[model samples]
Target chain A: MTLTTTLIAGLVLGGTYALVAMGLTLQYGIARIMNLAYGDMIITAAFAAFVVQALPSMNPLTGLAIVVPGGFIFGYLVYVFLLSPLVKRAPDKATLEVDSILTTFGLLFVIQGVLLVLFGSNYTSYTFLNVPVSIFGTTVAANRLIALVLALTIGLMFYALLTRTRWGTALRAVAVSPQSAKLVGINTDRAAAVAFAMGTALAAAGGTVISMYQTFTATGGVVFTMKALIVVIMGGVGNLLGALTAGLVLGIVETTVSTYLDPGLTLAATYTIFLAVLLWRPEGLFGRRV
Target chain B: MLTLDALSVRYGKHIALDNVHLRVDPGETVVILGANGAGKSSLLKAISGLVTPEPGVSITLDGHELAGVAPHRIPDEGIALVPEGRGIFTALTVDENLALGAYSRRARAGEARQRDFIFDLFPRLAERRKQIAGTMSGGEQQMVAIGRALMSNPRLLMLDEPSLGLAPVVVGELFDALGRIGASGVALLLVEQNVTISLELAARGYLLEVGRVVGEGSAAELKEDPAVRQAFLGLNA
Candidate 1:
């Protein structure tokens, strides 16, 4: 694939991946909790969306009518109930990261087990009114294009929320110093819980799209999770613009190589690029100054 | 007005602040003077709601009990603690940090009016409004910290060691700011190792040693006492 074609494909894919990877970047960036269970949690969300869509008279996209709210609720519950209790207002950036990874991985195991019991061991695809769309003469599967557009639109919306709103400003304020935040009457934990739910909803939303774009098994989520991590890592933590850039960069690279070579090796190339960039720019390609 | 009755803090086996009692009236400025381990810092922390106290002991702020009041709620109760080390948010600009202090009063009438009041108190801060707080000089950071505490529209502002490390001239400048603040009629609870200036700026003071209040009197009495002058003010200086 040429650069233009690769870019077009990459933009769509990158936008999608950015949505998925954003939660992890934020989790790692602020409190420094590593979310190793990124893939499994998302897969669980996909299955949940699948179950909703499977309802006798429901459209899968309409499942988003269920998934978005459902996603926020469940994600908020997970943060407040599960993760918030174990972590301090500001835990050690390194150790809690590993603990977060382990904890999420455990969630992955539990979710996969539940899915295996209920949905059985099988591949699934959501095919609700498949439509085709074109962008810059690029042929886009209707479902993928909508997902891509939604992912980018949401990314921008969050960017605005973070920069514009008082709540968002308080969230960043808590990010600066919990002690100072408290002095100003900002509840540090509430902000963290909100961030967790907000990030998780974005990830779950990615699950809705991924459910349609490819065949998914209860276990098919790990590779995509790793790929999303690559995008997030390259983008840098706590940086929405950087995440967007990294996601698109990964999208373009992976799409071009997968077009020319076997798609299976896309992960290998992604990991290689991830390591190289991380080695070159330890904070990330465009990480915030510490 | 503020009062602490039998206030104490224990860190496991270590007694950081043994039983201590003190009181301040409205429009009165008081300083607690001590050496490094004299619990002067802990006394301020206790008043600020940052330290745990022995139960049943009361820390009252403007007649409201504040012993166990949450840290964030302290400011709203009309007391602000400019904690030790000038706990300004390093990443925030001076203006943003100060505005956050004023946020508690946003729902109340006259918040913008209060913010403009702070800008006048610290003209240097107003001049460097866009600078990151951590990047500023020590005297400037101290001004930001004091300005931030004032932004809470506090009835009582508690300062812990505001003159930790600075030139004598800078320290003199800080005392001038405190004098202006006092003239405005806000009561201050100061913890300082610099005994002469602490007593000079304050109306009354207590001397602490090993977590206990060992000396108490009007600032004039303390300055005149031989033991206080010898132990704290260094009589010749």
Candidate 2:
């Protein structure tokens, strides 16, 4: 029974991680932007969901209809107005990586500042569907179960879209080789913009679902960002299936550690795995060696 | 028809192409022959908008000025380039690479027909459509590149060193495929190091020496020229 409870909890956490990391992969892998502001975007979406929930007869899930598209538009505008100039000025990918890191680092602080001013940096959460339900002889919170289902559904949908559609294939082509993408008549800049937007949309969806089950503060975005980044690296940068599998592994490890040993050692366990992976397989678990 | 006038490309202080003028009419095959550093690649790059030519240069294809067009837009303008190193999406499958080749608006109408034609031209590609392109042999990768370019339904196809690192037998098979593509009414602008097979494939030829066109003639004239025989064909004058 205890094992089942831990596994279920871990899966819920892993689902959120997988969804968020998928977005980061798209931004970094396809758009070539090491977006330091990614977590802040999630926090912003969480806040948006919070506000929507405050309205009469509304919930976080309903907020997704607005927040997801809102995130996409915001991502598009950010890429065009903030990042495209850097892309144009940078002579190569290495230069662009450095430039985007510096730029989005500044953007991180700016977004955090705005969220703090707006929400006052206090841990904020709302109650909606906090009822518990039994699953295979273990009781779990209904909202968390909903979040898990949503995350898995959306993540798998994105995976299918990437593998099955022409536009998605073009995006993957750009991720694989931007120079070759142009030879096939794909406007790489446009593809990058779309990819960045899609990434933020995923982020927004993850955040909204997370808001349904977790406490989030205006300044708490960095923690989510770091977790997603770890998942992405563990899975192999730009490898979607890798990210999904790594996220579940990390979640299960953290939960198993917390349940079996000391709860405070969960973070330590996460770092131990991260360091081990980095030392042994720097290309990531699934990534091909460069 | 394609025409280039006074096209010059500079790489920092180095001149890769110097006021080079060239032409290729519709359904024609022209080859540029030059030793290393003779600016053959630069000329093709300029035509495909991969590199910018100097101001006042003119590159027109079928009455469309393409000198300053964006590289991505060049494909929509009915030009395709199989760059050095094949430039195929190595991570993608052969089928995906060909699918992307028909991404341009002009190629959408005839995508199925073009794929059929490419498979007929290089049956190896049809056999390995599901294989990842990078894992393929050099000859097969070059076929994917050429097939992908053909998927664009290009009026003028430009190739830069398509046979750079292939085996001798593979090079022969590759040129045979190129001959079939040329015979199918697509204009080819080729830069080749192999003078013998290129002379046999091309109708006209130009000799580029140090970024300038030093000689231009029919393939027969170039093959018979004593300088060409000595410099390219490796025969005593």
Candidate 3:
């Protein structure tokens, strides 16, 4: 019964991780940016939800009405104003990689600082759904189940868009080879901007879901970004389905390790798994090791 | 018609094309023959807007200047380049590659007809439509490249060394396809080291040596010129 409960917890955690990791994959794989600022976008959304929840008789989910489109436009502006110019002027591929990392790293701190200034470094959350529901002889948090369901639904929607839409086809092609994409008459800048918007919008949605269950601080962005990056690397750089599966696997491992061993060692276990995967399967579980 | 007036390109200090002038009228096939390092590829790159030409170099397609236009915009203006080594999106399926080729609004409008025409022209592509482009043989990839360019409904089709790494039989078939493309009223600008096949397909030709145009004439005149025979035809003149 304990194992069943743990597994349920793992599944919920996995869903959240999948949501976050998908966003990182889009930013890194499609836009070709490491996007250290990715978690900052999440933090921003979390704060936005917190503010909305603090308002009289307001639901934090309503924050999505603001964060989703706001995050996309913010990301689009960042790509258009900050990243694209650097990409355009980059002398070579290696330079673009390094420059993007450094630039996003700088942006990460700027966003974190702005959030700290505005929100005063408080650990806050929205406590709307704390009810427990029984499932197969174990009780699971209803809020967590809701998060998992929402995540899975959104993931499916995202997958359909990627596989079934013309924009999705163009995005995939641009992700693989921008030069070929351009030759095929794709406006690569617009493709990249859209990639950034989609990625950041997903980040915002994931953060909103997270705010419902966890007390999060401004500095929480770093740890979240690191975890999402691990999931992305373990899955495959550009494979979304790989990210979903990898996220589930990670959540299970983390939960199991915390349940069996010391809770403090969970972070260590996560790093160990990452290192093992890197040594054994550097191309990731779903990627063809190039 | 496509015209290049005093077109020049440079990579830092290394000059690739120097004050070269060339033109191709509608439905005409023009070939540029040159030795290795003779700026042949650079000439194509300049016209395709892949590289920015030096100041005062003017490229016009149907009297519209294309010198500073972005590479993606060139295809929209009815020009397509089958780059050297066949720049097919290797990971994409053959069908996806062709679909992407018809990406411009004008091309998209007629994509179905163009796709049918391509399938008729290269039946192998139709058969392997679902196959990944990278897994195909080199000659087949060349066909995909040519077919992809055709899908764009280009008024000017530029080819850079289409015969490279191809078997003689495949090369013959490729040139035959080029001949058919030229006969279909699309202007052809071919840059090749294969003088014999190119001369056979092209109506007119130019010899580029060290970034400069050294000779220009009808294909028949170039085939018999002592300099062309000595340098390109492997004949003692």
The TM-scores of all predictions, comma-separated, are 0.89, 0.98, 0.94
RMSD score of candidate 1 (Å): 3.0
Segments in model 3 whose C-alpha atoms lie over 4 Å from true places: A53-62, A288-290
Report the error of model 1 at residue B40, Å. Answer: 2.3
Model 1, position B11, has a per-residue lDDT of 75
TM-score of chain A of each: 0.89, 0.97, 0.95
* Candidate 2 lDDT, A1-290, residue by residue in tens: 39999999999999999999999999999999999899999999999999998888877888889999999999999999999999999998899999999999999999999999999978999997999999989999999899999999989999889878888999999998888898888999999999999999999998998899999998888888899999999999888888888888888888999999989999999899899889998879986511
- Show where candidate 2 strays beyond 4 Å: A288-290
Docking class of 3: medium
Residue lDDT tens for model 1, A85-187 = 6776434656666667788888877878888888887997778547766667666677777777777887788767865666666666776677777776776
Interface Cα root-mean-square deviation for all models = 2.1, 2.4, 2.5
Kindly list the per-residue Cα lDDT of model 3 for residues B131-229, writing each as its tens digit.
988899999999999998899999889999999999999999999888888888889999999999999999999999999999999999999989899
Error of 1 at A277 (Å): 4.0
How much is the lDDT of residue A246 in candidate 2?
Answer: 88
Clashes of 3: 0
lDDT of 1 by residue, B87-158 (tens): 887766787777777666532465676667767777888799989888999999998888888887888888
Q: Evaluate all candidate structures by whole-model CA lDDT and list the values in order.
A: 0.78, 0.92, 0.87
Error of 1 at A202 (Å): 1.9
In terms of TM-score, which candidate is strongest? Answer: 2
